[model samples]
Every structure is written in structure tokens, then in C-alpha cells.
Target: MASEAAPGSIGGAGTALPRHVAIIMDGNGRWAKKRFLPRFAGHKAGVEAVRAVTRAARAIGIEAMTLYAFSSENWRRPEEEVSDLMGLLRIFIRSDIDELVQENVRLRVIGDYRRFAPDLVKLVDDAIARTAANSGPILVIALNYGAQAEIAAAARSLAAKVVAGEMAVEAIDDAAIERELDTHDLPPLDLLIRTSGEVRLSNFLLWQAAYAELLFVDTLWPDFDAAALHQAVTTFAQRQRRYGGL
Candidate 1:
């Protein structure tokens, strides 16, 4: 079980803020249903939430903020929903890439790119290339990412190296595995937030969040805003990370 921490004061002043934070955006469908709107309406609003959270995170001194935008399991949803999601992603990239670059926010997409359409793949690649020179806060989008799949893939790579005699079996360690993970270049995950009161990791950064502080809130993804982000970070600042030590 993960350790629990008491909610801290609401301001980040004089507190240690997390360098890396990840969020599991949940309850979009529910939010839309409550408004008697289509699910896509909720997703569209969620995009706005993303923009707000990105700006807030950068302003709060966070080095990296990863958002669980899409999961491998999400493919099971209706076809129309999937297509709408893809469209929204394209719109987001085309519309927000400039602002991201201007703000010095490096955009990174982590997941299986092969599963996307050619144009979508190109958009993601181009976004990364355009922001490659930026030296500021990083925004990682976990699209079609699954933590267990990532772990298995990393293990296979290590096994292949051992089979080719490029790396000894005994040389495989936590550090080595980490280098193979998608977030190897980013800072360690410090805080993970899940909206809609979800209490699970949902296959998000499982390995990187080994010692991260988890905060679950009742606010739906579409309703999440900069203020909500600030509150979460403030709560994180008050946590005690023992990392298995006394």
C-alpha cells in the first residue's frame, strides 16, 4: 500500500514542491452526462483543463508534468469516441504547439506511436522536434501508454542484450531498467494526482511513481483548473517521503 499524508496548507510558499508531477484525468464522461451533453463535450472541456494545468504547473516551478491522456485500454470504447479523441488530439497539437514552444514547454508524447494514423504520428513527431530546443518545463502526454506493457518491453530489451552477450545477466538492475523506460530523461515522479476520486494508478508511471505522493480528488477532469493544481501541489509539499527509511 502507498503511504498517506495529511493535506497541507494551500499555499506553496516556504514548502518543497514536487519537481515532477503526473495526473490521471478521470470522470470526463460523467461530467458530460451530468450536463446532458455528449461525452465528447466533456473531452473538449478536458482539453481546456489541460491547458490551464500546464500553465499552472510551469508557473509553480514544476520541471515536468505528465498527463494520462489516453490509455491502451481506452481503445475498447466506441469507435466514434475513439475517432473524436484522435481528432481532438490533432486539434490540440496544431492549435497549441506554438504556445507551448513560446512558453518554453517541451512537449513529449510517450507510447506506441505505430498505433496512430500516419498524420497523427507526424503531428506528434513534429511537435517534439519543434520543441526539442526548449529548456523549460516539460509536458509529457501518455497516449496509449500502459505501464505493464512498458515494463515487459523493457525486460525484453534487457534480455535481448544478455542473449547477444552485450550485457551480462547480473548487470541488470533497477537503474538499468529505468534507462529503458519512457521517462528515463525526466526527473523522478514526485506527485501523482487522480481526479474524480479514483484511487488507482490506472497503469500510469508505475515504476517512476515508486515514492510519489498520491492525491485523489472528487473534481472531474473537465472541471479541474489551475487552482485545483495549486492545491494539489501544496498538499504534496507537505508530505513526508520516507522512501522506506526511518
Candidate 2:
């Protein structure tokens, strides 16, 4: 997790890099267990990894990054762990919003983030609004987000539109459904990475990642840094994307 790692290691390989990237930040608890520290410590360090990866993206000229901060299924975990996660969310927003604003990174949330505590919800909204006009890199945090739930919500939205005579049933298509999704504003997903040797998507961006190249790395989330990101992109560069065609 070297902070000073150079971003040029990724973008200068001559092969194309993904315009948009999503990460399933996994293995924080395992990382903590390996170090004999509480899981909360790993989550806290994972926050720094988020910062590092965001910086790496900006430096390497990537477009957008989406992080799976917390999933809807995470509520099934122990109450104290969930509480620690919420607290870390508060601290990350309050402390990092200024840096994000100054860096011209637009912040977006994909999940039902407003379901959190009123104060915390306000904090997230304010932070988002503060960075709304940034023109360069984008950061999307998926907190309490589930792809299935998002898709179902989008379906309901389309159904309502049809009922209101705004859209014909025949008008429903892949593009129409996509426009109703939380990631509608983002460019098509180009790469999806899961750290800590995880090989599954775990309900993150199932539809958008339909054609995106997948990378599962062994590094834990807390230890993933710029160099690791560069390595991932480099690997992505070497693959030939057929997009389901020859």
C-alpha cells in the first residue's frame, strides 16, 4: 500500500485501459484476523485503500470508479460490526469531502443511502452536492446497495411510466431498463475487480458488468494500493475483449 506509487505504471502500456472500473472491496475482516486486530481496524484501513485507489484512478486518467462500500446483505453481520461500519462511513465522508471537492472528483451513491440515520444521510447528501460540479474523475460508493434490488426498483419505475402513459410497453428494452438504473449516468462498466482472491461478483453490478472484464486478485482490500491497481489494469490490457463475438 505504497502511497507514492506511480500511476504511469498502468496507463502507458500501449494497450487500452478501462474507462470505468468497479471494485468489490472484500476480505477486510479476514485481513484483520490475520493481523490479530478487530475487524473494525481492517475496515478503517480499507478506507485509506479507497483513498489510494481513487487517487490512483485520477493519476492514471481513469474515468469513473465504483466501490462496494456496504451491501444490503451486510446487515446480517454482527450488530457491533455493522455499527462500526456506519461510524467509519461518517468519518470518511466528513473528513474526505473537502479533499474530494478540491480534487474535482464527483461523488455518487448507488444504493438506498438515504435509509441511514438522518444526520448521516444529510452528511452524504451535503458531500455529494459539494462535489456535484466536478468535471473529471467520478467516485461512486455503493452503500447498502444490491443489484437485484436496484433492478427491481428500476422495473417498478418503468412499470409506473407505462401506467402513466409516458412509455409504451413495447418501448421497454435493454437501453430503457438501463436508463432507469442507478448507474445510468456512468459509462458502460468496463472492468470489475474483486480483491482478496474472491472470484464472484457478490451481487455487485450484475447487469452493467455483463460484458465487463473480471479480475480477482489475492491482495486484501486494506493492502491494495496504486501499484496493485496498476497491475490489475495492465492485466486487463492484455486480454482481448470479444464482447460475445469473434
Give the best candidate by lDDT.
2
RMSD vs true structure, all candidates: 4.7, 2.2
Q: List the residue pairs that clash in candidate 1.
A: none
lDDT of 2 by residue, 109-204 (tens): 999988888998999999989999998789999989999999999999999999999999999999999999999999899889999997899999
Worst 10 residues of 1 by lDDT: 1-10
Instruction: Give per-residue CA lDDT, model 1, range 144-192, as digits (tens).
Output: 9999999999999999999999999999999999999999999999999
Runs of candidate 2 with Cα error greater than 4 angstroms are 1-11
What's the number of clashes in each of the models?
0, 0
lDDT of 2: 0.90
lDDT of 1 at 155: 99
Q: What overall lDDT goes with each candidate model? A: 0.88, 0.90
